[model samples]
Target: MAASLLYPFVLLAGALQALGNSMNAQLRVALTNPWLAALVSFLLIVFVFVAMAAVRPQPFPEKASVAAMPWWAPLGGIAGAVAVFMGLLFVDEIGAGPFNGLLITANLLASLAIDHFGWLGMKPKRLGPMRAGGAALMVAGIVLIARS
Candidate 1:
């Protein structure tokens, strides 16, 4: 699929993420334990992904392919779990708008730095004026959200 066509899906995914964060916060309260809530939430994700992989029936990676992967590659899932746990722990205390705004601002800044430095094997994209301006605007937006 072309990148243009994926934009709507990305927008939808963002909306769903906001919803998920709120839901997860409630789940934490209902379960009365942060660890248990996170475990149950991630277990559902694991089961769904496992079911999807089983249905898709992709070819298994060869030993050489697996061996060639970076050791940190698997850390992506751990990083995601940290994000989910943050949502479960903090979203209720801080409203969704402020929480998401700060989260997105941090994500944008980190992404800009990653692109600028070509970190993690990504091709370097210079942080030109336009990108910097966009980031400034995002910061302003976050400030407004946080203040409100």
Candidate 2:
């Protein structure tokens, strides 16, 4: 599918992500322990995925396919959890706008590097002038957001 066609879904996801951070921050405060809050939040996710898998069972991955996976492949969840944990710990302190701004700005910067280098099996896209300009604009926007 063309990326433009997919853009709305991504936009919705971004909006939901910001909401989730705020909700998670509230969860942390209510629980009074970041670790417990994160666990409760992620445990629900685990249950939902497990239920989905059970309902629509697929063949287990072939041993060869499993063996071919990189060691870092399973770490994606860990990385995401770290981000969530940070949000849970700090979102209320920093306020949603600035926190989300910094988070998204960092994400964009890292995404640019990842795309430029074609890391994690992505197709290599050169850091051309337009991409660079877009990144600069994102940084500028984040600065304005953070200051506001």
Candidate 3:
């Protein structure tokens, strides 16, 4: 039961990561001003929420449910908005393909470190030589791509 429950969460995480990268690329191409991009992104998010509410209205959750969220919870969306704008601005300097490859590689390394260290309440996993080799290869590939 637990394994089955976890599968969807894993898939969801992967989908979110891919979507974020693609959206970053699109945002870079679409918006000249970072502030405007952020505003537009937020407006779109608001529109989605409003549309959903209109389609299937639901009562607000209890105060405790809302209050239980950490301060960083809200900051995550804001930070992602800023990151997309910044990535768009800088992507030309580093070719988009190479930059995205490097970004994915970096995200993998960071996630591995977080998982291995048991950061953020996650269970620790052993970091083996295979993982290290994979990371090295990813970096080398990024370098080659950027150089070309």
Candidate 4:
């Protein structure tokens, strides 16, 4: 029952992502600049976060709390920027299905490696036959989607 209820939210997330991608892709096409499109996308995120912070008024993290985090934690923005840039650059030309498929493939492989090796302080999850099979199936599905 819980899984079924949660599934719609997952679907909704994908739907929302698709809409965002399409909007950004159009913006990039109009601007003729992926970098500008990405900038606008990120600026919107900043706006929303700023509004959210105002509405909720959460306390700022203490100096010690920031100091305790790994140095690499601060570099996550680069990854987010790359995602926005790539989506702006390619989503319209390549289409969402193939882009998502390739993204998912890369994400799954990276996640599996991260989990298996406990990289960046994640809990270690040893890979097994089922995990291997699932990853393989995902790759196969992506291949089929790309071929289509």
Candidate 5:
């Protein structure tokens, strides 16, 4: 499947992410601590997901399944905390548009590496010419957004 075909959904997700980041930033400001905001977010996430699981009646994940993962598998949650905290820190400095552009650009480059290397059990993908060009174009767009 072509990435372009999935771009719309990804774009929508980006918009939602922007909203979440802004909301979380405000929470950080109100609480006067990024960690508190992250804690609140985690609490809310646990509540919602737990409710969802109950509604759907899915079986709980086995301990063995979780134990099968590498020790660093839990770092993804830590990464989310870092991302949200940085968003809180930089959004006020750079404005939402520029911050989002830079953040998304960084994520794009990191994602390219992750995909190409098949990190964390993901299927390996070649860094083809077209994909590289697309990433370059995204970087150009990010620069333009930041400059504006």
Candidate 6:
């Protein structure tokens, strides 16, 4: 029960996401296109990973131990990166707070659906009336913020 008190982790995650979005918005302003922005961002992330690895090298699996994953695996990363950069640009045209509020609302709804259906092998959660009502309120808030 005490472990469950880590619920604040959700708030921390949201804060980190908001911070990441702000950085992405800044990068979007510097780049000409979303694709270019994503590319640069990806390169920077890879560079950071390499630098960390240099400081603390981790064991790598043998080539034989690696199995080919579905092509969709890599495509998913590419798609996510492209979508984030594009979303940043779209939201920047409006406003960061509004865009983030709507985006967070969308994420909440999507997570609810995923939890309800247990998509991708996730454990399904019962979506009671309370959860549904809360989701509805979130959507309403997003709409109000967007319209403001």
Q: Ten consecutive residues with minimal summed lDDT in candidate 4?
A: 80-89
The TM-scores of all predictions, comma-separated, are 0.97, 0.95, 0.67, 0.89, 0.84, 0.76
lDDT score for residue 119 of model 3:
77
lDDT of 6 at 83: 48
lDDT of 6 by residue, 93-118 (tens): 87777878877887789889989999
Worst 10 residues of 1 by lDDT: 76-85
Instruction: Please give the lDDT score at residue 20 for candidate 6.
Output: 74
Q: Model 6: residues >4 Å from true position, as ranges?
A: 1-6, 54-76
Model 2 lDDT vs. the true structure? 0.94
lDDT tens per residue, model 4, 2-104: 6898998988987787677778899998888888878888899999999999999988899999999998998888986776678788887888999877877
lDDT of 1: 0.93
Candidate scoring better on TM-score of 5 and 6: 5
Q: How well is each residue in 1-148 modelled by candidate 3, as lDDT tens digits?
A: 6688799889887667556656655675687666676667768879999999999999988999799866666776676665566565666666667667777787788878988899765799878898888888988888888788
CA error at residue 70 for candidate 1, angstroms? 1.3
Question: Against the correct fold, how does model 5 do in TM-score?
Answer: 0.84
lDDT of 5 by residue, 45-95 (tens): 889998998889877689999889788988998897777778866677788
Candidate 2 worst ten-residue window by lDDT: 139-148
Q: How well does candidate 6 match the true structure, expressed as C-alpha RMSD?
A: 3.2
Model 3 stretches with alpha carbons more than 4 Å out:
1-31, 53-71
State the local distance difference test value for candidate 3: 0.74
**CA displacement after TM-score superposition, residue 69 of candidate 4 (Å):** 1.1
* Model 2 Cα lDDT, one tens digit per residue, 37-82: 9999999999999999999999989999999998899999999998
